[model samples]
Target chain A: MYKNILLAADGSNNALRAANEAIKIASLSNESVIDIVYVADYEKTKEDVLHASSADELMIERRKKIQNVEKALKDNNVSYKVTILHGLPGPEIIKYANERKMDIVVIGSRGLNSLQEMVIGSVSHKVMKRVYCPVLIVK
Target chain B: MQSLKQQWFGNVRGDILSGIVVALALIPEAIAFSIIAGVDPMVGLYASFCVAVIIAFVGGRPGMISAATGAMALLMVPLVRDHGVEYLLAATILTGIIQILFGIFKVAKIMKFIPNAVMIGFVNALAILIFMAQVPHFIGISNMTYVFVAITLVIVYTLPRFVKAIPAPLVALVILTAVAMFSGFELRTIGDLGNITQSLPSFLIPNVPFNFETLQIILPYSLALAIVGLLESLLTAQIVDDMTGTASNKNKEARGQGIANVVTGFFGGMAACAMIGQSVINIKSGGRGRLSSLVAGSFLMFLIIVLGDLVVKIPMSVLVGIMIMVSIGTFDWSSFKYLAKAPRTDAIVMLATVIIVVYTHDLSIGVLAGVLLSAIFFVVKISTLKVERKNSHYIVKGQLFFASTDGFIDYFKSTDINEKEITIDFSNSRIWDDSGVAALSKVKDMLRDEGIEAKVIGLDTSSQKVVQQLDGISSSH
Candidate 1:
């Protein structure tokens, strides 16, 4: 049923699972295009920039995570485009999805552990609450 | 050494100008604080001069000003009221000794434990306390005094918008003081508050008797002063460090403050600490070196010696107006706007801290209460951890720290499966500390006693390493 699928990846096993699910769903349609997005959270990056000596090191670390998702998509032979955005993950993802008129958003249930997710609510939960399109949160 | 000299004198002209600006701002504040502590205005002035000069050389953070602050002044009131300036001097000495000990013990590292909520609460509480201190001058004062205060406030707030080069408070003080003098009103000038000794501060040991009784009297106040002084100083240093994009030696700062206070006490100055408002003013005015602070101290003394008569004639209402502006500027208004949207626990902690601080007039107690409450809330939240049971597997999510260990074990204990092989998945959870390892051991022991086979699985590399080091197991199911 989905045409433009947005897969939000953070390189976690859960995010990989969501990526796999998105790839499977997209395989059924010939015209469907998948966009794998990774949000380098602005606040987290700012904190890392402050605490870490080198900004390049933090950027490299984030690049590694994005590369992992890219490699997974390449290995699966999925035809997809990857975009990395810098901002809060939830709002940025939702905004991008709405602006791009995404048919469905596939995301991991949690990127950080449950305790942190409980304390600062999971990005997926926020995206699910606010996104206009259908959301498939992979556990 | 050459690099150090270059660094120190990098911005000589800018530092000198900023130092002069900071010095001018420091005068009325120092005098007002001395009055607040129930001592001669010279005592506060001398303390400001001594601490500023000393900290300029030895303070951990460069580009930050250290001087007599309202927080330290508030603390000295009870001390000066109960046992006179002699005993207060003794307490000041003792406070310095304790702060030195704190530095040697590396107590500044504990500052990281203080939550953002508590810090915000502290800033707001101090602002409220400062504003309240000015209330007496407004209430029951003469009509002309009221008019002068209004004009002073007006000048303080509006003058800055028009002219950024001149410090608004100094202008307001000068204008209002001249107006009060010309109008021939029976107003309460700085002279009315306390005598301003024209002579420079002299070195003298405190004359309090050194005995057990004296120690008992001064110990509590000294401890309070030492802690409050260090807290404010170190916090202000952190703020300046952030503003300047530089790291400060917090331990060194603590020790420097201790040394400054000790020297201040010996020189007949009341206890002093870092003033955040003045530090910001210094930085905003382009101060970037120790020379700025040194010049600030030297210029303050120069003003006291040369313009002592003019300083004495400044109206108390003008200082009150400046302080009110300081109080308003110090408060974090963002906390109020964010209260509804912030996490409930954080909001409660901040509010509780503000209320307790305002009511008790004790910043330390309020912060302590907030930290205690935050810890309790953390435990309560973590204790709600649950384990989901499936066929031959149990999924453990949430934190596996000390607070949630008992709850985690209890969940597995209630299960009546006997002699069954079970796998526990921990991919969704994390082991924060050694307590988590102990919890895993306890669970394994309990499961062994019930004749059940337990396999722990899905540990991340770090958690796996910790488990391997403790339990001597490498592979998980």
Candidate 2:
């Protein structure tokens, strides 16, 4: 029965599953609202700026990365808003979660950057270690 | 703000440990860069201590280490050799003033103009330069020196496999210095470079006349130092930002560097900037805040007070060995594959950057040449004005800028037009400048001479405005 929920999504299939899980938990409360937190990592932003031909194209690409989670919220008639954060995904998500004092943080077990995760521990794992709220990591 | 507290103290234990490691590594380098600049070794050490501490509070990039660096040292050689240390101090002050102006004007925005090819070349050049400077101590030194260098290299490269807590370079330094001392090895040491004074650097103006003649003497050198220092610092800041997965206020870092240099000049020290090699060491050792840099500066002084005697005895061979490891780590070895797979133009830019810097011993000039060559290539590629002919419709299908205007005329002049009337349509392209409009009118006149009427059509609003304004004046010509 969480009133304040943070859904960390990146439009991947795992993120879609996590979004569904967040929606199920939010339905149990009368005034529950969800915040969809999408983190655009600094390295990813650098690569994208280099590759994209125009600023508008970069914005469109970024929007596409979190489109699925937004679609899920709209279809469920859920009261939700999307917030874009920048930096390392794990630390940025945790900082936002702590600052907002969320009741729970629902995140995917796996992310889009598998190679990077292999090198540096996974984002969800880092979030579970540091975030001040309950973390529900859906596989 | 509460964020300031988080930035300084959020990771205290990790910061302190990493700072100590950086302090240990900074010792050999500060001494070596002083020898390169032809100044007393204490000058470089003083600058490193002052800059690192000041930038910890004033700089925009958290966790980045600034110090007396080889690039800045290379630039100071002529000034220090020609006028003396006092004049060099005056130049350092002027350099700081110029850099503050650059920061206020927000020079960080220009960083985007430096392409990735140039950056790769700059990095490779730096690594090569670092390696090259160690050659004198590396070869023909002595048989004993060789053994110590080999052992230091081994310990630096292989120790991380068994040890993760302490930095490899620190271990190499401590263990090799101990063995060299006890074994009675008669080898080159840091003391041969210069003496490291135990007392703190006192504040005093350089003993130089404050006049127009003095300004004239130091201005050129000061300008060179300012530009080179800012370029290296901003580039280093960008690298640290990428490594730490954060963004930095590059303009603020510029101003902070100015503050550091200004204070350093007054305190009998040379100008300095951020060091990429030490920064990578900082990051690898888990440093991620202002406290790390503050501790690095403080502990460097602390080490000199307590261990100054032993630090001067550090065998040059051991430092050379550690530097070799640093150079190997600094180079982007994957760039070998990058040369074969990347575009020929980019590859050429990268190579030109390396060759010019290595040959001229000037980082700014090489970077300038690379940027100019890349820009030339970019201009040539973007000047393609595809003029298509479908029946009597001549469609200009690319940007009609100054660079493309010559090609615009050449396309029509070389072709044989057998139509009585033809339409030159700007439906697909926009006219950008006066040269484009003049070319259009010139082509119209040339066609008119052949008894053919050409009508221009399909101009976008802005392009139409440009053409209409320049059309009558240029057609009269």
What share of the reference contacts survives in each candidate?
A: 0.00, 0.00
* Deviation (Å) of B128 in candidate 2: 1.4
Tell me how far the alpha carbon of residue A91 in candidate 1 is from the true structure, in angstroms, after superposition: 33
**What is the TM-score, restricted to chain A, for candidate 1?**
0.86
CAPRI level of candidate 2:
incorrect
Give candidate 1's error at residue A136 in angstroms. Answer: 43
Model 1 alpha-carbon drift over 4 Å, by segment: A1-139, B379-384, B389-393, B413-422, B430-455, B460-477
TM-score of each: 0.73, 0.77
- Superposed model 2: Cα runs more than 4 Å off: A1-139, B1-17, B209-217, B242-247, B280-288, B341-343, B378-384, B390-393, B455-458, B470-477
Question: For residues B1-477, could you state the per-residue lDDT of candidate 1 as single tens digits?
Answer: 124575479889989999999999999889888877889889899999999999988888777888888887877777788889998888888888998899999998877677667777777888898888888887788887788778888998888767878899999988878877898888888888787777878999999888999999988888878887887887777666645555678998999999999999899988888988898888778887889999999999999999999898988888888888888877877767658876899889889988998898777678789889888887788766778878878898898888888888888878787547889899888887778888888888788778887898999988877776766542222
Which pairs, if any, clash in model 2? none
User: Top model by TM-score, which number?
Assistant: 2
Worst 10 residues of 2 chain B by lDDT: B238-247
List the DockQ of the predictions in order.
0.03, 0.10
